[model samples]
Target: MIVQVALATGFVLILIGIYGALTQRNLLRMIVAFTVANSGVNLVIVAVGYLPGRTAPILDATVPAAEAAARIIDPVPQALVLTAIVIGLGVTALMLAFAYKLYEKRRSLDIARFSELKW
Candidate 1:
């Protein structure tokens, strides 16, 4: 029940982020939208990997080694999400830095203001 809700919410967030990114002209707004979309992706991945009523992928007294596979949740998605989060943060920081530099050069964050590459 909760998993479905989370998956749905994540999809909604992804859609909203994509819409915001497409419609907003400001560099900052676009960065924010990308971040939101990244978060949604992470959430969706985590939600998909989640197993209801299951424990972490660790073996202990509560879970024997033989039954560990059945009792533990898959760890690949969690690890992938963690790596994605770190990469996303770095990308966001780079984007913000580039935006700041552009803003400093033009005194504006509007996408239309910088058209030097447009042909």
Candidate 2:
């Protein structure tokens, strides 16, 4: 039940973020919405690896390493989500830089007004 709820919430957040990104024209708003969607995706990925009745993945003398490995949460999804987070940060930085340059060149923040770039 808990996992189901988490997954549903994540999907709903992702949908809302995508809708905002698609309909909103302001560059800053679009970037924020994209980040929102990325967060939702990250949440879902992390949730998928959760084990309800498992101990931590630490290998102390009390808990055997092999036993922990058998019941501990999956680490693969966590690792991939970390990578996704780094990539998302890079994309956000690049988008912000591009947006800043556009604002400087055009002296306007209205995305609609940026139609006729000299590109």
Candidate 3:
């Protein structure tokens, strides 16, 4: 129930981000939209990896190794999402830095102001 809602929400956010990125003329706005889309992707990955009534993939006294497979949720998606988040943050930072540099050079953040970037 909740998972489905989360999945739907993530998809909606992704759609909104894509729409904003495509329609926005400002470099900052496009960066924001891409960030939103990245967040949505992370959310969807986490939601998909979640399992009800399951524990983390840790082996402790409560969860013996014999039953670990059935008791714990898969950790791959979560790990992947975490990595993606770090990479995405770095990418966003680099993008913002470039935008700032471009703005400094042109005194404008509008995409059209940079004609050389079009080609």
Clashes of each: 0, 0, 0
Task: Report the alpha-carbon TM-score of model 3 versus the true structure.
Answer: 0.88
lDDT values for all models: 0.94, 0.87, 0.94
Span of 10 residues, lowest total lDDT, candidate 3: 110-119
Best model per TM-score = 1
TM-scores for every predicted model: 0.90, 0.86, 0.88
Which residue pairs show collisions in model 1?
none
lDDT of 2 at 27: 88
How would you encode candidate 2's per-residue C-alpha lDDT over 7-92 as one tens digit per residue? 88889889989999999979899999999999999989887878887755567886787688776778888899989999999999
User: Which rank order by TM-score, best down to worst?
Assistant: 1, 3, 2
* Candidate 1: tens digits of C-alpha lDDT, residues 23-57: 99999999999999999999999999989999887
After superposition, candidate 2 runs with Cα above 4 Å error = 117-119
Pick the lDDT winner. Answer: 1
